[model samples]
Structure formats: C-alpha cells, structure tokens
Target chain A: MKGYLGIDVGSVSTNLVFLDEEGRVREAIYLRTRGQPINALQEGLRQLAGRLPENTGILGVGATGSGRFLAGIIAGADVVKNEITSHAVAASTLVPGVQTILEIGGQDSKIIILRNGVVTDFAMNTVCAAGTGSFLDQQAARLNIPIEEFGQLALQSTAPVRIAGRCAVFAESDMIHKQQMGYSLPDILAGLCEALVRNYLNNVGKGKEILPPVVFQGGVAANAGMRRAFEQALGWKVYVPPHYDVMGAVGAALLAREKMAGGGSTRFRGFGVADTNFKAGGFTCENCPNLCEVVEITCEGEAVARWGDRCGRWSGSLGYQDEEIRNAV
Target chain B: MKVTFPHMGHMWICLSAMLEYLGVNVVVPPPTSKRTLTLGARHAPEFACLPLKLNLGNFMEAAEQGADTILMAGGCGPCRFGYYAQVEHAILEDLGYNYRLVVLEPPRKHIGELLSKIKYITGHNSWREVIKGIYFGYQKARMVDDLEKQAHFLRPREVQRGSTDRAFKRALQEVIAARDPQDLPKVREKVRRIMGAVAVKPRPVLRVGIVGEIFTLLEPFVNYDLERKLGYLGVETDRSIYLSEWINDHLFLGLVRGQRSRKEACRAAAPYLNHFVGGHGQETVGSAVIYARQGYDGVIQLLPFTCMPEIVAHSVLPGISNELGIPVLSITVDEQSGEAGLVTRLEAFVDLLARRKGVVVQ
Candidate 1:
C-alpha cells in the first residue's frame, strides 16, 4: 500500500488528505461545505484522487469531524473517529510533546488539554459561536476588509479596542459601536480577537489545565491577530502545524495507517465512491411516542446506513461490522 | 379519583408501584416526547425549566386520557422546583382541565405527616396496610435502582451489544409485575440471573460519572437518553441522582434518622463547595470529586439550560475538575438541543477519555 485516504466532513468545510505509509502528508485539499457536505466531500475526493499518482495503492480510509458517521458510510471508512481525537492525534503527530490544543473552526471552538501526547481533558463550544471562524469572517466582511488581511491589519493597531465577545450577536453590535466611536478598524479587529479568547476561556477553556507547548490549528489559526491575542493572554507561544486546516484529515489518515497495521483488510470501497450517487432522507419513527427522526442514507437507491433512531429498530436491522471498542467505563 | 403524575425517568415505575399498592387507579402520562414537550411548553410559562414543561405536558396528556388527580413531589429550596406545583396547577386551571393537583412536600421533621399524606392519596387504607404499601413501594424502588445499576455496568460489555438492553427491559417488566414484596426476591433473583447471563468480553472502558440536575439526569427524553447513548458508545455510566436515592436521603433519612449517600457526597464536596446551593448543585460538585477520587475516567454534568442551582454547580465544578484531575464535560440541554450535536460532543468526550487512558480507539 502506497498511501491511505482520510476525509473530514465538517459543518463548514470538507477536508481530504492522503498520507503515505510513513504517515507523511502527500496531498491536502480543503473545500467549503456551504451546507452541502456530500457535494463538498465528493468534489474534494474527486480532485484529490485525480491529483494522486496513478496506481497508488490506497490501503485504508478514515473519517472524522461532525459528519464522521455519515462520511464513514459513504467512504467505507475503516476507522470512523471523532474530530477531537483526530485533531489531538494530528496535533501530537505534528508537534511532538504538545500539551494543549486550541481549535476554532467555522461553527465551534475546542480546547484539548493533553499530557504526554494523550488527550486528558477537552471542552467544545456548546450553543455558542462567538469564538469561531464564521464569526470572525463575518466581522471581517462587515469591516469591508479581506479576511486574509484582517489579521495583518490587527497587527498594525497600536491601541486595540475591547469588544464584548461572550455572544456573537452582542460582539458584532459591540464592534459596530466601537466603530461609531471612531476606533480604528485594525484596533476593533484586534479587540475582537481578545474578546473571542476571553469568551473561549470563560466557557470551553474554563477549568482546564492548559500547559505550555500548545498547538493552535483550525481555520481560525490562519489569523495572526488571534495568535497574538492568545500569546498576550496565556503568555505562551502557540505553534501552528504546516497542514493546519487539513489536520483532521491528516489524523484520520494516520489513524487508518495504525488500524491497517493490525493486518485487517482495508474497507476502502475505492475512489469509485467519489462517483457513487448518495441520497439521505429522514422519517419520523412512530413506533414510540418519542417520534425519533430516523435518517437513512441510500447509495445507488439502496439503503446503506440508518441512524437517529432512539431504538435499534433501524440501526440494528443492518449488520455493519464496526471496530472492536473498549468497554466504556 | 383516577390519579396520574408527570414523568421523571423511572420514577414513574416506583410512583406507579406506590399508587397500585395503595389501591388507587393510576394512569401514567404517556412517556415524554416531542408531543408532551409541545403541550407542556404551550401551557407553561416561558423561562420555566425543561422539567416543568415536561411535567405539565405529562399531566395534560394524562388528564386527556381520564386522570382527574395529579400527584407531584414539591420542593422548598433555593431551587425554583418547589413552586412548580403551584404555577403548574394555575396553568392547568387556566387550560380548563378538571383535575386536582396534589403537591407532595416533605414532612420535614415528621413521619406522621408523611403517612397522613399517603393515607389521603389512598383514601381508605388501614394504617397497617399503608405501612405495608409503603414498604412494598420502597422495595420496588430499590429493586429498580439495583437492576438499573447492573444494566449500566453490563450494557457496554455485553457481547451482543444491545442484548443487555433487551434483557434489562425483560427484567424490568418482571420486577414491575411483582404484586407482593415476597414476589420481589424471586423477581430480583431472575433479573440478576438474566442480566448476568449475557456474555461479557470487557477489557476496559471509560467510567463516566453523570451528575447535575435531577430532572435531566433522570428523564432520558429530556436529555436525549444520554445514559443509553453513552452505554452504546462503550462507556460505563453511573448517574449520581435517582428517585430512590432522593427519597432515601431527602425523605426517609430525614424522618427516620438514618444516614445515606448525601453526607458522604457533602464531605467529598467540602473542599470545593462547603455549603449547599440548593437543589442538586452541591451534589453535582461533590459527585465529581467523589467519582474522580474513585479512579473514574471522567464526569459529565447534564443540566437544564438556565437552571439556577445547576448554574451554581457549574461554577464550582471547574475548580474540583481541575483539583481532582478529572475531566468534566458540562452539557446544558434545553428543548432545542439537537440529538446529532449531542452525539458529536459525547463521541468527542468519550474519545478524549479513551485516548487519555491509552486505548487504541478505532
């Protein structure tokens, strides 16, 4: 096997990365999901497969992110892991001895505190999007500055304003208020970063032991403004991996490599999956008063996976062999 | 009069047992769901906790099905739960439901008062029979709790995945069918044997201690069947709150002058939170310390969004979570909590725990 394929289908972005047997990233691709994860995934995979060397044997596949289960069934992933694990693994693999990880994506932010390459504690944004990529993007668009230049502009600010960052709506309105008060755009952007960090610390990062050697990655990590704010707040240097945005996919591929090492046959249905017709539909299960909305995924007009059922009526009907997992303590 | 009560997880099982033992016609509100929540939210005041809305729904549905009297446990703490009965009653009255709302408050310092309240519900039971009925109800409550504990312990390790759940349902049905206390021993033995019969190949799993408000912790529908979700994720879930534990500590122990788990929880929580903040807030903090000290993997705190007592608990939990070196995931649930979003968080938390323990997660 020459390489392994990893797909990470998130709410805002779909990432695909191919890692060589040596666990080195060979190709990395990122595509905006825009509320259509399947299309984003298919386009990303097709581009990824087309770019790869001809006849490169793919041994195994892994899927992660919010849509791991869905992407796993679609891609025939050998290992379906969560984004936290994927991010932590990729962070650890990239920056050895990483003690903490801060990931802010489009819709959520997470803080994973690690001890000796193991994720010890983690907290994700719950019902809050204040310290996320989308919020930052919105702020940038509102300022009429390209998001790519917003960070650099913040770096030029001599006096940063303080904006409320506990809620996205309040933060946005606060930024507008700061603007009306004649604060420089760069200063407001810088203030936004500080507020975001404050909100993240007060919420998800609360009660966590964040040690040094912190690795910050995700779409938001591209912002030098946020990076500087983090340094000023925590007084610690934050390292961004080379393939930051695609780290989840990289971790997935690495995990796939680890699992395939156990000598099990690859579950990779091949790049042919990119061309497969996938349709998902949901129905309310009236078997009980709970009225669980069962989601069914069909490929080529045949049901391949079913979930969202509180009971095992549909999930148990199909016999899909998953990896042997440790008993939950 | 035909009596019913809003759902509180498995409390219905024990409450039903109590009513039946007292020889009253009992109608359980249909198991809580979207319909129940909608009806409750429609009638309940906005800003009320999820439990209040759920209970209201339960009562209305049960009333629609012919129940004329509603029995509910009332509280009198810093928590807003105590006044729920009065407000719910008014709402029901405004909704034009012809039903009686009987709020059962703790007798506090008197066992006689508690017994009298029971007599009031039973209508005409002799003192001796009331005692007998009380004894039977307590036994069933305990049995259900025990059976559930075993199910929690065994569900993740069951070789056939959901076979343990199937066996548990069967065992619960058998236990629920017991008409006499004597029948309990037989039922308990059968349940033990059946749940024990499931094959196990347990290596190790994350031991998650679930703590927080009593309502969301107990009512699966309210919290999206969190225990079941965790169990299927291959985690051992031990809830710190239960109806039996509540009755034992808050009611029985208070009146009978006996000790239960509350003292120990309070003791454990002393360093982090010395005073009770009302409701289960202190318990939630203390339970995390207790669970952490017990070598558990992590703790998950589930609370209704905007719950005061739980907010208090949430404030103090981080200190203990840090001091005790236990990872705590605080999940605040409301009516709009999406199941998929919950699953992702749970999966991530479980993955974090497994990775922490050096498990080769797939």
Candidate 2:
C-alpha cells in the first residue's frame, strides 16, 4: 500500500495527515505548536509513524502553513503551498459545493469565499489574534477550565453575556466585568464564543459575501461552541468536516496526491528525515536593496535547501558547484 | 535652520507647526501636481508601488526646493511601509541627491521615546516646550483632519463641473491661513456655507474607499492623486486611515500581538463600521459596508497593489460586495499602472454603479 503524507506547521499548532491513493484520510495527528514547531512536528510525525501500517510506503509528502517553507525543508516535502490554496483545496474537496471557508487556527484566521470550487475571495489575519484559537486558550486558562471542556461549558450556558469582542484587552476587561456581574462560567464561555465569532465576522468576514455551504475548519472548528455560535450568528448551518483539525495537512496531502498522481516518484526524502542531522541558518543577502534574508538548510555540512531569497540569488548561487563558482568568479 | 518633510495632504499643517515651535523654518513641498507624478514615475522602478515612486519623487522635489533633511518613521512588519525608508534612501542615492534621512523607529513602548526624538529633530532642548509643541501640533492635525473630512463631503457640491480643483485650492488656502485650531471651526463653517450655496446637480458618481499603506493613499504623486482622479469622474471618495492611525498603531497598540492590535482597529473604526471583517483590511471593508449601507452607489478599494494585508482584504471584498449587493472595483496601484487605463476603469465602474442604481449619466 502506498500513502501520501502532509504536514502543516503553524505558529500555534502543528498537524500531520496521511491519505491513501483513493484520497481517503488514513490517519491524522494534531498537536499544539507552543512556540516550538520543530518539536511539535517531530512528535506529530512519531505519532503518525506508529499509526501507519508497517508495509505501507510513503509515496509523497507536502507541507503547508505560514511556516510551510521551513516545514517543507524539514519534512523533505515534494510540494509546498500557501495556506489559502491548501485550505481552499481541502474545503472544496470535502464539501464539493463549499462556497465559503471560515478557517480560524491557533494564531491566525482566514476567510475564503469560493465560487464553483474556485477561490474568488479570501482574507487572512496574521497580525491580530482576537479571533484566533490562542485568544480562546488564554480565556480558557483565565476561567480555570480545560480547553477541551470549553465547548461543553459554552453549550451549557442559559444566557450568553455580551463581552466586547473588538479587541483582546477590551474582551479581557469585559470578561472580568461579566464575571463580576454574576454570570455563570458557561454563560461567559458562550458569550466569548459569540464574541469571537462576531469578531471573526466583522474583521475577516467583512465586505465579503459568505455563501453556503459554508465549511468551517482549522483547529478552532474542533470547538462545537464556535460552530454553534457561527451558525446562530450567520443564521445558517456551518459544516465541520470529520478531519477539521488537520484540514490544512489533509489539503496539502490531497494536493500532493493530485500532483504526484502520475507514475512519477515523489521528491520526498522518506521517513528517515527523522534521523537526518539538519541545521537551518539565515543570512541577509546584500545583492540589492531588497536585502532578502535567505535561510539555508545544511545536512551533514552539505547545503540541501535554500529559501527566502526573494530574487532567487542565493538559490542560484547554491545550485552551482565549486567549479561553477570558480568559473563565475 | 528649517527642516522640511515631504508633504502628504494636510500633513504639513501639523509638521510645520511642530517645526515652527522649534524655531526652524518649515519649507513644505509644493502641492502635488503633474510634475510631481512625472518626476516620480520617471525615476521609480517599474514594479514598485505608485506610492513609493511618488514619495521618492516628492523627496527629490523637496530636495530641489532647498530641503536638506527628511524625517520618516520606521515600521517592523510584513507591510511594505516598513521598508520604505531603506528603499527611498537607495533611490535618492542613485539619483545623486544629497540629504540626511533621520528615521524615527516607531516607539516600542512609551510615547516618551518618540517625544524625545521629536525634540531632537526640532532642536527643542526643553521638554516642557516639546510637550507643548506636540500637544499643539496634534490639535492642529486633528482640526485639519476634521476640515478635510467635511471637504470630502462638500468638494463635489461646492465645486462646479470640473471645479473640484478650484474648491480644493480655495479650501486649502483658507485652511493654511487659519490662525489656530480655534479658527478651524469657522473655516469649516465657511466651507460648508459655500457648499450649501452651490447648486446640487445629480450626477452619476462612484464612491471609492482608498485603503492601504498610508503613504500611498495620501501621497497624490504616488497614487497619481487616484482619489482626485476618481473624483474627477464624479466619484465620491472615503479614505479611513491617516498618519495619526499609523502612529497610534505602531507607537501604542503594537506592544501586544495576535488579536490585540486587530481589536484596536475594530474599536477605532466602530463609530464608522460596526463589525470586524478581519485584519486592518476590516477598515476598508467596514468603510465599504457603511458606504453601501448608506446608499453609496459603488465602492472602489485602492491599495498599493501587492500590499499583503490589502491583498488579504481584496480577496475578501468580492464576498463582501456579493453579500452586501454592492459593486466593488479593486485597483492595485503599482508604478506600472497607467493613468489613462485606470481612468477608463473608473469610468466603466461608475457607469456600472449608475446602471445598478438607476441613475442616468449625462
């Protein structure tokens, strides 16, 4: 049996997924990024390794997310794509009629509007965190509730309090004020869910027409409370696919599968990537005013991959052997 | 010695006032014109955004008019505005212009650092005087912005057909001549009174909201006075951001990352736009939502074209328009954009908006 592997290493979370040749998900692993993407990817791969059949050979590998470039190099991926394309691809594949995608991950959030399976419009919030999963994590910690139980608490609410969802500061103060006002934990949690959904709608969903069948994915989609809140706010049912948490990875896997569907072999370095001694380093290119900070990866003192060169100058330099370098000089 | 910065709309009124308090001569760059655009376009990279090219042109023009030093703010982010100083410096150097570029790294924590830098630039040794100058400068800028807002609503009415130039010239002259912040209300009232006196003609107009990098939107030479050009085609304009917001975003709220700054913009734009669409892109979407809700015929989103944040916003705008039932035309301004082609798009967009609104164009 042959399978494809996909990894998405984000600022807030890392995900790994495996898909069979039939585009069916065989196994998926989702883990918290916790500011250590390298460790998260390693742990996730370990978990995925245990689940795979011993005889199953990994056919191809793909990586996506904000840290896709780094993760791609680390995973020795055959293909790499941005979150927009990856998410859109996954959502469209799952819900063939998916017209809009509301994907809120750990640290960032995005809204993709699709028309006839094509991404017509999209927005991403990388700088702000008010609507992302980390905000909810902080609120969960503040409330002394486990993140896993947050959705259940939200579901238990009788009356959801209205907290300021405009910003995290105001939301914090507002959450405190609600607590002082004698709101139950469940009500507060529910209110937070509503407020976050409201913030997402206003910020990322602004000006864009969100059409149905709207597919909500990303790590945040794992929270049933958020799904309910979105449904209530938008006055429509929001679909959460079975593999919501690792949709980015699944999408990347799907893309890799599609790209490498032909008899051609994948450029993936294989599972032995775990044993490889690799070091990633960066240096600023002084070639032009662009001053691109090119990051290069060296495996056993041999340069294997170079990226972040906006002008491809560093990549071009690395491709040449010592003879080419001498001749050029 | 007088220190001058490149003029961006009513920016000079505040900067000049600040410079004046330091006993420095403030030589404001001449108002943006065809020459400014020509000069900027001639020297700027073909792929560079219109604003960058225009700002570089503005600096060159300012240097030619006897300015020796330029003060600019620094940013640290994915936004192209962060790299403006470095690129502008290189462009100026390549052009053989000699000038000192004093970049004020955005205040990471307290406003005190920024105040001290302002003091340093102005040569105001006294903190008390520097504080006074800053307070007064801020007051003047707020007042100017207030007048400018009124002018946006009034410009179409007060000016005759193709007379936006005359009305703006008159209003700017009156604004420049105002003695103080207190004098602004009277100036505004005068402008309003004049607008009321002019005959209101019903014309097909497309209202465009210019949002993106602050420099590109306000600096006419960069965007080729895109707003003015759109206005020339009988389009109403609404731009939600200014230098003040940029200052506040960098100097103040930027301390917290993730959702904190995102919420800050949403709070700021709440009076105008009641919801968050996401990112600072929400600012543009919020304004467009309000514009559409308030019966604006059509919406145009203007960005530096390749600006990541705005691109994110642009991606979502189609859905926004689709949902709101508003026709939105997005124009990305890079150096390569031709004025004639942009004008034609504006013409077509206006025509479409008019057709949608059942307004007949003459």
Candidate 3:
C-alpha cells in the first residue's frame, strides 16, 4: 500500500494521519503535546508506523498547525500550510459544499467562510485563548470529570445555567459560582458550552455570514456539548466529519497529494526518524541589542535546523531559509 | 545640550540630520528592541498605547546615554496622543531622568510656542539657517520615505530574497551621511537607480494597503515590521501615512509641492466617516476605500491597544470591507503580541487572497 503522511503538531495535541493512495485515512494517531512537540511527534510517528500494514509505501508528507515549521523540518514535509488553510481544505474536501468551518483547537479558534468551494473570508482568535479546547479540558479537570465524558453530562441538562464566557479566568470563577448556587453539574456544563459558543460567535465568527452546511472540526468537535450549543445558537445542523480531531492532518495529507500530483518525489525523511535521537536547544544571541533567542534542533548531535533570529544570521546559517518554507506553503 | 528623539521607522535619520545641520549635538536612541519594550512598559501606564510606552523607553535609553534634552512632537486633537508629551515627561521626571522636553506643538495654534521650542533647540542658528536646516531635513525625510516606498514596491518582485531590504538599508545610510542639501537630489536619483536595479522577477504581485493610527503605521517595531513581512509574503504594500507626509500635513511644509493633502483623504472618507475622529481615523477609512477602488487585493489595519480613534475606525472597517468587497484584517498590538500569532494571521490572509484571486494553483 502506498500512502501520504500528514502531521499536525498543535499547541495541545500532535495528530498524525496516513492517507492511502486514494486519499482515504488508513491510520490516525493522536497524542498530547505535553509542552514538548518533538517528543509528541516522535511518539505519534512511532504509533503510526506500528499501525500501518507491512510494506506500506509512504509517498509524501505534509505538516500544519502552529508547530508546522518544526514538524516540516523534522518530518521532511513536501507541503507545509497554515492551520486555517489546512482546516478549510479538509472540511471542504469531506463535506463537498462546506460553507462555514468552526475550528476550536487547544489554543486557537477560527472561522473559515467558504463560497463555491473557495475560501472567501476567515478569522482567528486574537491574543486570547479563551473558550478553546484547552479551556474546556481545564474545566473538565476542575470538575473531576474526564474530558471525554464532559459532553455527555451536558446532554443530560434539563435547565442550563448562564455562565460568563468572555474571558477564561472569569468564566472559571463564574462556573464555580454556579456550582456554589447548587446548579446541577449537567446544567452548568451545558451552560458553559453555550457560553463558549456565544463567545465564539461574537468574536471569531463576528460579521461572518455563516450560512448553511456549517462544519465544526478540531479537537473541540469531539465535545457533544459544544456541538449542541452550536446548533442551538446558530439554528443550523452542524456536521462533524468522522475524523474531526485529525482534520488538520487530513488536510495536510490532501495538500501533499496535490503538491506531488505533478509526479515528483517527496522529501519524506522516512519513519526511521521516529527512533533517531533528536535534541532541541535555544540560546540568546547577545551579539546585538535585540538579543534574539535562537532555537536549534539537532539530530544525532549534528545541528539540523536553527531559527527565531530577527536578522536571520543564526537562522540562515543552517541554510534552512524561510524562502523554502514559504515556497512549500 | 544633547538632543534626543523617539524612533519612528526612519524618522530618526531625518531628525538627527536636521539637528546636526543646526549645529546641535544629537543622541540617537538605540534601535527599538525587546528590552526597549520591556523598559517602556514597566514605566508607562498600564493602559497607555504601545507608542507611548515605546516613547518612554526611548527617553530612558537616551537619558542613560547622556541625553539631557528630549525633542517630542505635540498636537491638539481628540486623540489621547495630544497629551502623550506631557505624560511621557511626567513619567521620565518620576523615573529621576532630569531631561528637558522641548515639544514642538502644532504651528497652526501654537506658532509662538513652536518657534520658541525650535529656537531653544537650535541655539544660536539664525532664522535663515534654521529654515534652511528644516528644509534640508524635510528633503531627507521625503527621500527616505521615497526610498522606503520604492523598497516596498521592489520587495515582492525582487529576484533574490532580502535584496530589497539590503539596498534599502544601504540607501538609508547614504541619505543619513549626506551633508549638503544640494547632494540630496543626487542621493535621491541614486536611490531610485538602486531600487530600480534590484533585479525584479516581473511576477504579478498582490497589493495591500495599510491603514491605521499614524504611529503604528510609521513605526515598524510597534506593528512588527508589517510592511516587510507582507512584502516577503509576495504582497506589495502602500501605507496610509509616512513621516514626511505627516510632517507636511502638520507643519508649514504643507506648501511643499507633491505632498498629498489630508483634505483629499477626508473627502474620500466622507461617506463612511464625515468628521475627523482624530489620529487618522477618517484617513484609515478613506485609504481603505481608495485601495479597494484602486483594485488592491486587501487592506490591513494596525492599531495600538487602547487607541480610541482606531477602535472606532476598526468598527467602521467591516462595513467598508463588505460594501467594497475587500478583505480587512485589523491587528491590535500591545506589549503581549506574539510574532507567531501575527504571522499565522498574515499567512492565512494571504492564502485567502490567493485563493480568491485564483493565484494559488493548489
């Protein structure tokens, strides 16, 4: 079997997916980033390698999400794209006429408005990570409930309480207050989901003409409570694709397929990279007043990538110029 | 008296050159950096906009370098910036920096005050020499702005990455080192030739108009070098305001030919914003409309956090964007803005533009 590999190393979770030659997801691996993207990616790749059948031929690789540049260099991605493009592509591909895509990941939430299979407008949360998957996870942990069961609890609510959701810290305090007021756990959870949906609509989805065929993806889509809240608020049937959590990976794999459609070889570093010893370190460049903190990634004690310098001195030293990254995107 | 001023993109070059021509000792603040922002944010009011914080940082750094006199521009308007000079001075005095602030207020309403401030800074220079120095500085400002504008034009088309920035930096040095006013025209011609010779690939480039508060539009540090970033993303940018344009609009230099009149912008913005809400609010709306009508791909608005006028402008931007069928991305920057977040939005915005225009094959 021949397939394309897609890796999405986001803030909260790193997801890996393998798309067969026909673009069907053959294998998917999801792992917690745990504040270490490299380790999470390696673990994911290891799991994916074990899951794939013997003699599986990897044709291409793609990377997305915030840690895309890091993932690209490590995975040797043939296509590197931003999360918005990746999500939109995946949503549209799966749900042919997906007009609206609501993606709430760990640290970011975005709304992509598409028309006639092309993206028209989009918006991402600005400097605020409130009402995202991570916030939900924190609330679920505080309530002593597993994140997977948080949504099911919300569905049992008979009377949903209103919780403030403008800011995450305030929202937590509001939830605690509601709990103190003796509101049922289900009601409070449902209300929290509704509040998050309201905030998402007012902020990220502000001024966006969200018509029918709304698709909600990202890790947050796994929450039935959020899905219900979105339906109640938007009054539209929201579709969650089968692989909502790994949609970014799916989109990346699709893009990789398109990039390699012209019949060119991919830059896949091979699955052996999972076992390769890699080290990441950073140093503050004091050569100038700016004092840029440059990060370097090494494989087998040899530096492979360097970045984060403003003047491109240290970053350019490794010959992994941004021009190549930009071209890939 | 060692004179010092805040950095606004390349305005430092123009100001330092003008002061040097007037036979005044000048202390240029070091280029804005993370330390500058940290120092500024620590001393400045928590709610003050990014520009004010940066100005405070510039003063503190300049004071440490033995600068005893600070040159700051003053204005009278609805914008909070009119009181920035006073607030910055108070903050510096509280920080124990015994620096004298010579604020040149708008010449229209404070002609006597402006002249005295200039006279104090210029010392024994005759009125003729002062006027000549001012004109010389104005020339340099125009040349510098022209070079920057040319660089923006060349950045998206340059065959070699970073070549346009390289030429721009070298050209700025030549403009700064220029001593004689007569040599400015020669430098201007040379700059044109240098920018023209940057080896362009002749590829069609997306044009983006930048509109927002003047400080954010002029200062690269506050907005994170937005123009350079967009240029590198294969988009050409035309900003609403430049230092030279601001100088022309506010100073007696309005008589300078070729300087765009604020009246035109006000006229263009009349439909969306009839009156000046201050701090380039009307101009922001007008520039967006102008860019859209000019067949530009999109408009980006840069606003400093807590800026009153720009917040109003931002609210009105969506209407214009929808009516005009152009995409507008309003980015707010404060002390906490991360570069990664900005880049992601920019890349997504560029991707949207590319898809809309059918430029991206995939």
Q: What's the TM-score of every candidate structure?
A: 0.94, 0.53, 0.98
Best by TM-score: 3
Backbone clash total for model 1 is: 8
Question: What DockQ, on C-alphas, does every prediction get?
Answer: 0.53, 0.02, 0.63
Model 2 chain B lDDT-worst window of ten: B254-263
Tell me the native contact fraction for each prediction.
0.74, 0.03, 0.68
Off by over 4 Å in 1: A321-329, B109-113, B254-260, B360-362
Per-residue lDDT tens digits for candidate 3, residues B1-362, read 99999888889888888899999999999988888999999999999899899999988898889999989988787898888988999998887889898888888998998899889999999999999998888889988888988989889888887889889988888898899898887888887777777888778678899999988888887888899889988899999898888888888647777777677788889999998898889999988889999999999999999999998899999999999999999999999999998988998899889888878522
Instruction: Summarize candidate 2's per-residue lDDT along A1-329 as a digit string, tens digits.
Output: 78899899887889999999888988988888887666677788778777887788888887887667667767767666667778888888988999989999887788887776766566665335797888888888988888899998899988899989999889999999989989898898899899999998988787778878989998889888999999999988999999998899998898788767655777676666666676777898776544557778787778866765543456656654322211111
Residue runs of model 2 more than 4 Å from their true location after superposition = A284-292, A309-312, A320-329, B1-362
For candidate 3, give the lDDT of residue A141.
94
Residue-level lDDT of model 3, residues A1-329, one tens digit each, is 99999999999999999999899988888899999999999999888888888799889898999999899988889998888999999999889998999999999999999999988889999867889998999999999999999999999999899999999999999999989989999999999999999999999998899998999999999999999999999999999999999999999999999889978898888889999988889999998878999999898999888888888788767665566676677
Per-residue lDDT for B91 in model 1? 88
lDDT of each: 0.84, 0.70, 0.90
